[model samples]
Target: MASANVVDNSDHSRFDLLVDDKPAGLVAYSRRGDNIELVHTEVDPAYEGHGYGSLLARSALDAARAEGLRVWPLCPFIQSFLKQHPEYLDLVPQTQVTRFKLA
Candidate 1:
């Protein structure tokens, strides 16, 4: 199994996924006050079907949790992810939970 690692590249507003030290995927986001708006998630075609996308999403959300920030899942992928992973629901702000249908 390949070693997977996730790194936050705040300079580019994205969290990168490295599979065995190679670029595999990324989660793009924007910091809004105390919230992090997930804008998009992409995995390299060659790296697809290997669970890299989920890794990216999990890492990004974990970062938000560590930073004490809220999550605004603007990307369709993130919206779906959040719905499936209700354990992270608390990271979503109460005011916007209904908008994202996570309530």
Candidate 2:
């Protein structure tokens, strides 16, 4: 896998993704207890097919993982990504696992 050049902007808090000096996409989250609610995510139309959204989600997920926080991905893309990529399964809240259809 080719390493993605994902930058953690804004002091490890709000996360945004820029590709080649342009705003390619972004992911927003709010911390709730030991879980972070993944609020939103979007990829520029031009950047949609290049997996930029996934890059943002992965970076945010990585941050949550480091903090020992379970994730509640309300963003549809991140929710779908969670389903597709099972390796990150441990990062999801066990109670919501059924809602996310991870079982």
Candidate 3:
């Protein structure tokens, strides 16, 4: 069965975006005591602008939601993704929004 939860590739400290079972991109993060700091997100140049980055963003956020962790999106890409998708605004604590410029 296809799992609802995204895989956490801890060895690499990132979530993999797979295409045909191969990684097309990754969303990297660092752990912070029940919170996650999104550090970098990248898709292969061949996969750029193909919504793969969005897939990585959504998967990372959804995983954070499922794990009851808050988010600190430091990466510009992730920050922009959150801006485009306000539904995830709540994942970041209200007080820290301006600090991250996510407000």
The top-ranked prediction according to lDDT is 1
| Tens-digit lDDT track of model 2 for 4-89 | 45565646446778766666777877887898888788777977787788788889888889989988877788888888888787
lDDT of each: 0.91, 0.78, 0.83
Off by over 4 Å in 1: none
Provide the global lDDT of candidate 1 against the true structure. Answer: 0.91
TM-score-sorted candidate list, best first: 1, 3, 2
Per-residue CA lDDT of model 3 for 1-103, tens digit only, reads: 3122246897888998776676677888998799998999988886676677888899999999989999988899999988899899999988668876776
Candidates by lDDT, descending order: 1, 3, 2
Among all candidates shown, the one with the greatest TM-score: 1
| Candidates 2 and 3, the one with greater TM-score | 3
